[model samples]
Target chain A: MNKTIINRLLVNRNNNHLFKRTYSSVGNKIPRDPKYAVINSKDIDYFRSILKDPNQILTDKDDVDPFNCDWMKKFKGNSQLVVKPKTTEQVSKILSYCNEKKIAVVPQGGNTGLVGGSVPVHDEIILSLANMSKVESFDPITGVVTVQAGCILENIENYLVPLGYTVPIDLGAKGSCQIGGNASTNAGGIRLLRYGSLHGSILGVEAVLADGTVLDCLSTLRKDNTGYDLKQLFIGSEGTLGVITKLSFITPPKPTSVNVALFSCHSFDRVQQVLIRAKKQLGDILSAFEFMDRPCIDLVLKHQAGTREPFDDSTPFYVLMETSGFNEVHDGEKLSSFLESIMGDELIVDGSVATDSKNMTSFWKLRETITESLGKEGATYKYDLSLPIDQFYQLVAVMREKLDGKALVYGFGHVGDGNLHLNISTPNQSYSKDMLDMIEPFVYEYTSKHRGSISAEHGIGAMKSQHLHFSKSDPAIHLMKSIKHAMDPNNILNPYKVLPQ
Target chain B: MKIFVPVKRVIDYAAKIRVRPDKSGVDTNGVRMSTNPFDEIAIEEAVRLKEKGIAKEVVAITMGPKASEEVLRSSLAIGADQGVIVNTDKPLNPLSVAKLLQKLAETEKPNLIIMGKQAIDDDCNQTAQMLAGLLKWPQATFASKIEISESKDSVKVTREIDGGLETLSMKLPAIISCDLRLNEPRYAKLANIMKAKKVQLTTKTPEDLGVQLNENLKIVSVEEPAKRSGGSKVTTVDDIVASLKKHSLI
Candidate 1:
C-alpha cells in the first residue's frame, strides 16, 4: 500500500490503553491552590453550557484521572473535571467562563513531560487541547506547517513525510508529545544539532491568556523583525503565562538518504575530537552527536529487552553519530571515509555502522532507551544541564565520587549541543530527602562554576522552580515573576509553576 | 539455497483500526499501510539467512494492487535481493493467495519459502499452510526461533505453542511461518530505501501465473465493537465496593 495512504488509514489504538495507570503510587505532597474557587453546580452548569458537546467535559474519575499525572508518574493531581475543546473559539469561551468564576485551570497537551508541568497540581480544572489536533495549514513550496497546539509531533512527522518535509523537533517522546507542549517548553531535542532549536523554527505562536484574551500573533514568514517578538515569551512560558493553542513553524525538507554510526571512545576528550572531525568531514549532514557512559549503556542492556551491548569489550564511553543528506551514494562514501579516518587516528577503539534499518533502529534504541532503562533501575534525580563539551562528564564523575556509591550518578545527552542529562540514581529504587539534599547545592554550585545552565532542554516545571536561582540572577528571576504576574494576575493558569514561591 | 518470502500489505501495527460505519470491512480510507508485521519478521529471517551465507539470494514477492509495489520496495529495502509484485486490484482470499503463490513457486522453484503465519488484518493464518500443502512440502508454523543445520539441507525451528515451545526439524524446500518472538526486524534505512529503487522488481499478473482467481469466503457484514462507556471515579474504598456491588461484580 502507498505509505501516504496507509499512513492516513490507521490511528494508533495502543497508546490510550497504555497510558492508563492506577492513580499514582507517588506521595500526595504537591499542594492545591486555596485561592481558586471550588466547583459548585453552577460552575459545572456554566462549563456544560459553554461546551456544546457534553462528551468533551470529562467528569468521570477514570476518564479524567490520566490527565492528573505527569509522564514520569512522579506527580499526581486531584483534578475533578477535564475539558477538551475543538476550537480556539471554544477554548476562549471556556477560559472566559472560568476566569469570570475565578476557577483555576491547568492547560494541558499530550501530558508527556519529565517535570510536573502538564498535569494539574490540585483540584483545578484541566483544560485540554486534545480535540484541537489538526494541521491548520501547510505550504508545500515554503515548507511551513501551521498546526494546532494539540497535534502530535509524530503524526505531523508522518503527515509531512509525503510532502518531503520533516518536523523540526525530534525526541524520544515524539510519539506522544504535542508540538504545542514542545514549543511551550522550548523543547531541545536530537534535531537541535541540525535544525537549531524550537525557538528558531517556531515562527509564530497563538495562545489564550488567563483572562481569555487571544494573543493572535501566529505568522508564517521566514523573516520578521517586528517590535518586541512577544512569541518568545510563550515559547518557554510553561503555561504559567498563557495557554498555547496554535503555532506555525518553518520545516526543513526531508533528507533523501540517512546514515547512523556508533563509535566507542576511551575518554570524553576523544569523543569531542571525533565530533569536531565528524562536523568537519560530514559537514551539513551531521544530524546528531550523542554520548553515553559505560554505566548508562549497561543499565540499558540490563533493562531494555533485546538490546545488547553493541561492542564486545565495554569502553569507557560510546558516541552515536547520525548523518543525512540528499544523495545516498555521496553520503555513504563520505561517512565511510570519516569512519576510516577516525579509526586510523585511533580516536575510537571500535565502531559499528548500521548495515540496515533494523540494525540502525536497534543502534538508536541503545541511545534512546537510556531514560526508560534508568527508570527501571529506580528513582532517578534527573538534571538537564548545559556545560562545556570538554568537561561534561566531569560533573557526573564528581557526583559519583562524592556520593560514594550511596547512589549511582551517570551522564548522557546530546554532546554536540552541550546538553548533558546528568542522572543521579537510587539503585535501591527508594527516593529520600537526604539523597536530594546531598546532590542539589553541590551539583548547582558545580554547574554554576562551569558557567553552565541548570535547565537545558527540559524546562523548569514544578520540579526545578526553586533551583532557578542557582542558574539565573535575582533580577532575571524577578523579571520572569513580573511577566508571570502581568500575564496571569490570578495565578490560575498553572499556578505555583515555572516560578519559585 | 535460495529463499522465497511472500509478504502482504496491511494496516500498520501502530495504526488504530476502526470499522467503517457501513461495516463492509476494515476502513482503510486514511490509514497508513505497510508490510504486514509478521511478514516483516519473515523478511528479516530470510535476509538474516542470506547474510549468514546459508542462503544465496532472498526474493520477496507480494500480490495486491499496484500500491503493493511499495510493500515490495520495502522488502527490498529490508535486504531482499529482488522483489516481485503480482498486480491485481481485486481482493484475494487466503486460498486464492496460496494458489497464486503455488503457481509462482512452480516457476521460481526456490529451495525454501518463508512467510508470516498470517496477515494481522483478516488473520486467517492459512496462506503458508495451504501453500505448503499444495506444494507437498514440509511445513513449520508459529516459528519463534530458527537455526540452520550444518548440512543446510534442513532447518531447526522452535515453535511457540499455547502450552509450551515445540522444536521441529524440516527439510529443504520447506515452508516456515514466523511468529512474533522470532526476531525484531530492522528498520528500512533511507540509504537502503534509495538502494531499493535500483533493485530489480519484476511485475507479473495473477492471470499470467495460470492461477484461478476465486474468493470462496465472503464477509457477511462488518460492524465495529460497541464502545465501552467511561468508568466513574469513586472518592473512597467504600464507594468502589458499593459501585462494584451495584454492578453485581463483588
Candidate 2:
C-alpha cells in the first residue's frame, strides 16, 4: 500500500560468481527467500549489452507517474515498475521472461484518453510506446500512410499536409491524441461528418496479443475480402485484444476550398429550417452543421470577449455552417447565393460568412469553445446523444420544459450526424443531485424512446457506462462479453472497466 | 551478452475505463492504447545496460497482430538493436506465448530477459513466471535493481518485497521483471530515429515458431467495477468523528 512496503518487497540480489564485488548503501543485510527473487548479476550485463540505446530509458518512480493514468481521473494502480521497449524482439523477451515469472504487462500510447481502459486498476507493469512514433512509409498513389501507432494525430497531419493529403478525421484533442489510440478507440470527431470513420479509412493494423504475440494485419490493399476482418476487432477493442503498434490508413485528398457561415436563429425550429434549406441547396458541399444553445453562446461571448457575433440582434440559438469544395470561386459564389436565399426566407435572421482563412478560424472558435465555455459555468452535466435530427431537438425541448424550474437547461447538437449535446446547470450546488437523479434518467429515457444512442462521438467511458443499456441490446452485450472472456480470461486487462459489473 | 525484452501494447495507463451498463464488456470506443509503462522501463533497463557496456545487444519482441509491431519499432527508437515479432491474429495466453518465445530463445539465447511486471490492459501477472517455469530458469519478479557480474555469467538482483528489499544471486539466463524503480526510460533522439528505420526486424508467425496457439483460459464474464457514489462532504474533523461514532467505527 505504501512505497516502503513495495520497496521492501523488492530487495537486491548479490552474486559473487564470475568475479563480482557487491556494495549496498545500507548495511550488509542480505535478502531471505524473498517473495520476489533477484536476478543473478550476469543477467544484468546481458540485458544491458542488447539494448540499442539505454540512455533514454527511465525506470524511476518519478518517470512513471506521468505515464500511469489517463485524461479521465478514474482508473489508478501501482505497477512499481515501468519499462519502454523500443524493438519487437525486446518486447518478446520481456514477455517471455515475464511469462516465465508470471508478471503482467500493460501497453500504452498517447495517454490522452477518456476511458480508464489505459491505466492499471492493480499492481500491473506498464509498457509505454511513446518513443515508437514514426512515419514508416507513405504512398500518395495508393493514398495510404504506414506509421507507428504512437505518432500524434497533429504530427500525422503535419507530415501529410505537405504531400497534399489529409487525415480526414480530426478532434479538438488532435494535438495530444495519438494515432494508435485513435485507431484503438475508433475515434469519431468533427470531421467524421465529412469523412466516414476508421472502419473505412484504416486499412490494416499491427498489434501484440496479451502474450506478446505480434499479429501483423498491416495490409495496404484497400479491398481485401479476407476470411475474417480481424483488424476491425482491434480498431475499437480498447487494447483488450492486443496492443496496436502500427496503422495503415487511407488518407484522402485535400479540399481545394473551405467556407464557413455563422447564423443567428430565433429558435431551434428556425435552426432546423435553415439546415433543411441549406442542405437542399448546398447538398454534398455542406460539410458541417453545428447548433449552439443560448446559454452556450452567452458563455462563449462572455469568456472570449471581442469574438464578434454575426448579428447585432439577439437570438436564442446559433448555427455554425461549413462547406468544402474543389473550386474556390464557383463554390464560394454558390455558398454566398445559398446563404442569401435562406436569409430571404426568414430561416436565418442574421449571419456572416468568413471571407479569409483568419476569419474562418475565428468562426470555428465559436464552435470549438463550447467545451471551454461550459467549463466556465459551474457544475456542468454533459449528455452526448444521437437521435433522429428532428427528434433530437424535441428531446432537448422536452427536457428543458421538464426542468424549467428544477434547473437551467441548454441543448445543442451536430445536426449533420444527428448527435446532440445537452447540458444541465443549476444556480445552486444542491440542484446537482436533483439534476442527476431526476433529470439524467428523463433525458436517457427520451433518447431511448426515440431509438437514439446514449453516446455519439465521445465514447462511453466511466461517465456514461451506467446508461449503456439505453443504446445496446441484450444479445449485443452478450457477444461483447464473450469476446472479452475469450481474450482476457484472467480478467486483468484493465480490470473493473469496459464491462459492466 | 545480448538481452531481449518483451513489451505488450495495452490501454494507456491513464484512460478511464467504463463498463457498459447493459452487461456488455468495457466500452472500448475512444479508449486509448500505449506501451505498458513497466515494459517501457524494462526497455530502458536494457538500453542502459547496453550503453553501460554490461551487454552487447538488446532485441525487443512483441507477439500480437501487426499493430503490436509498432511498440517494437518504438523500442527501436528507444535504442533497441533490432527486433523479432511472432505475428499472430489469434489471442493467446501466457503459457502459449512462453512456448513461442521458448522456441525463439532456442535460437537467440538471450542472457537476460526483462519485461514490465504486468500489463495494464489485462493485469494478469503470469507471462514471466510461466516463461521461467517453461524454460527452467531462475525467475526474478518485480526487480527494483539489477547488477551484473563482470563475466556476465551471473547477476545480482534486488527484488521488491512486502517489508523490505531482498537481494539474490542467480546464474546466467535469468528472467527479471522490471519494477518502476529500475531506471529512468529515455526518449529516442531525432538522430536515432533515422537509424531505427535501418535496424533489422525479422517478422515470424506462430507457424514459423511451430507453436499452435489455441487459447485455454476462458472468461465467464467481464463486469465493470463498482462505482464510488458521490459522498456528502464533512464540514470538519470533529464532525467526521461524530459521524464515525454514530457509525460505531471507533
Candidate 3:
C-alpha cells in the first residue's frame, strides 16, 4: 500500500473506536449549579456599598451583556450584574461576601479567553478587574515590575519597553488580554521559546481566596526556596482557584536588535530539521520559531485585510523565525550562516529576510493573523494542542482527510515549544453539531494516544472540563478536586470549570 | 537644504544616580546609557523636517568618547541620514563644544541647526546660543514649533517663553534650540537599528576639526544636595504654628 494511503487507512481505523464511544455529555445545556445562591437586590446593594463608584457597579443589561459573552461568542451566560473593583481590598470584600452568601462569582480580566473561561456560564455575578489597571512599582536595576492584574499586557509592555525592558510574555491578544489574565491562563506565546513560560517567569502573584482572604505572595526576589511555592497555584488556576489581583515578574532587558526571516519548507520533516538546526546554530539569540501550513496562510490572505501572500508559490509549509540579541552585526551574521546552511541542504526551498521593522511586522502578521482569520471563516472549532514535534503536522493531515469536503482543517502555531493550533471550520461558515461530534473525542483520543496534551496553553475552562480525564489521570483529577474543595469549599469561585463534576 | 542635529549620550533617565565615593561625579559603572531625552526630541524634529521634504539630509553629530557613537547610531535609527563623532575623552565646557560645532557648521554649511536646549547632565543651556553667536546666525532658543517658508529662504519659530509664547521669523542658516514640546521622539525600531549600521558615520578628533578644547570653569568640589528631613505631623493650626515658629520658618 502507498504510504499516504496507508496513513489515511490507519487514521480511519483509529477513528472508528473514537466514533463508537459516546460523547462526554459536553455542549449540552449545562444546568446552573443550584447549590450556589443567585444574585438578588440585596447582593446588588452590598456590591454598590463596597464599590462606591456608580460606574463600577454595572446592573443594566446593556452594560453587562459584553461581560456575559466570551470573546469567541461560543459561550453566553445570563449574568445579571457586573462589578468592577478598583483595588485589591475591594476584590477581597466582594469575594468574601459572595463566598459567605454562597453567591457564585466569575472573575474576569480582559475577558479575551478562547475556552470561555472568563465569562459566567450562569447568573453568577461578574467581577471585572478593569479598574485595577496600574503599575504598582518597577525596579530599574533588577528589571522587576509589579502591576495590577487589570493592566492590559500591551500597556505594560509599552510602559516597560521605553525603560529598556520588556514584559516576558507576548501574545496575539496582547491589546485586550490583561497581565493577570495571562498569568491565570499561563499563556504560552511565540516568545515562549526565548523567555520560557509564565510558570518560571512569574516570580510572585497576589490572589484572593474564596473566602476573601488575601494571599499576599508578591515576592520580587528571583531565588526563594522557602517552604511550599504557593504562588505557583494561581499562575495557571484559570481563575478557578482564586482571583489574581496583582503580579510581580522579572522583565528582561529589551533586545537592541531583532531580525525576522520567513522560509518555505517542502515538508514537515524539513520544518522540524530547520527548528533543530536553528536551536543549535542560533543558540541564545533564537526568539521565535513559528510554522503554518498552506491552508492557514491561504485563509489569512482570504479573510484578513491588508495582508499579502508571503510567497508567490505556496508550498507545504511556511516558517517564520526571529532572532533578538545585543549586536545586530553578530546576530545578522549568525542568521545568515544558518539560512545559508539550511538552504544549501535543501531544508528550505524559498526564503525572505526582513531588513526593516515594517517588513518584520508584516512577516509576524502572517503567523499572528491565523486566529482572527479563522474566526472570520465562521464557526471555528479551535484546539490548542501540544504534541511531539515529529507528529505535529500528522494530526493536521489526519483531520484534513477526515473532514474532507465537510470542513477546512488548518494548523499553525509556535513549533519551537511543540505547540500547534488546529482550527477547523465549515465551508459554508455555519455551525454543525455533527461536525462537532466528528472532531472532539477523536482529536482528544488521538492526542492522548500520542502522549500529547489536550489543552496546551489555553486551560480547560468549562468547554474542556469533561475532557480533562483525557489528559490527566484519575488520581491527578482527584487531587485537583480535593484542592478545589479545600480552598473553595462553597464552590463559589468560578464554578463549573477546570474539574469534571 | 540640510539639517544638523546634535545629540548627546547621557545616563539613562530611569537609572538611579549615585555619587562616587571620591565625590568626583555620578557613578556610571554598569549603568545603562541612552540618548539625552531632549536631544532625542531634537533628532525627531530634524527627521520630521526631512520627512516633510523641507530638508534634503539630516546629519546627527555627537562629541564624546567612543561609546558616544551609540547615541549617533540611535539618531541614525530614528531616521538621520549620517552621523559624525567628534572623538574626545576629555570633558568639554559649553564654550569648547560651541567652538567645535561652529567649525563643523562652517564646513557642513547646513540651512538649519536644531539641537536640544540643554543636556540633562550639565544643564548649561548655553551651547546652542554660543554656537549661534560664533556662527553669526539668527538664534531661536526654546523653540516649541518651527515652520519653514515655501521658498525655503526663511523660517518661523515659536519659542516657549517664561510667561507666554514668542514667535520669530528668521532667514535661512539659523539655529533653533528644541524645547520639550517640540516633538515626541519616535522609538528606534530594530530593523532601522540594524540598517543604521550601514549608514555613513565619520569619526574625527577635536584637533582634526581645527578646534582646541579649553575648560575655563573648574570644579573644586562636588557634593550631593542635603537629604530632606522628615516632617512631623501637626493636627491643629496651633501645632503647625508652633512647629513653624520653632524652626523660624513663619
By DockQ, the better pick of 2 and 3 is 3
Give the per-residue lDDT digits (tens) of candidate 1, residues A409-454: 8889999999999998886455566777888778888898888999
Backbone clash total, candidate 3? 0
lDDT for position A486 in model 2: 78
Error of 3 at A269 (Å): 0.5
TM-score of predicted structure 2 = 0.57
TM-score of each predicted structure versus truth: 0.70, 0.57, 0.67
Candidate 3 lDDT tens digits, B1-250 = 9999998888755454678888888888645566887888999999998999889999999999998898898789889999999999998888998999999999989999999999887789999999999999999999999999999999999999989999999998999999999986654544466567677789999999889798778866667889999877898999999999999998
* Predicted model with the maximum DockQ: 1
lDDT by residue (A1-501, candidate 2, tens digit) is 011101111111121122111111111212221333234434334445544576434446787765665542223445555656676666556555544554555667776555455655445567666767898999979989999888888788878866878787776667677898888777886777778888899999887665667789999999999799989988876666667888899998766566667888887778888888877888877878888877777776776654655456778888888887777658756775686677667776667654333345556777776665554444456677889866867876787788776666777768778888887755324223444666667777888988998777656544555567788887887888898777655443444445555
lDDT of all the models against the reference?
0.82, 0.70, 0.84
Q: Which candidate wins on lDDT?
A: 3
The CAPRI-style docking tier of model 3 reads incorrect
Residue range A60-171, candidate 3, lDDT tens digits: 9999988987765667778999999999999999999998999999999988788888988888889999999999999999899999999988789878866889878888
Candidate 2 residue spans exceeding 4 A from truth:
A1-62, A72-82, A88-107, A122-124, A376-379, A401-408, A425-435, A438-442, B1-250
Error of 3 at A345 (Å): 0.6
| Cα deviation of A20, candidate 1, in Å | 16
Q: Give, for candidate 1 chain B, the lowest lDDT window spanning 10 residues.
A: B186-195
lDDT of 2: 0.70
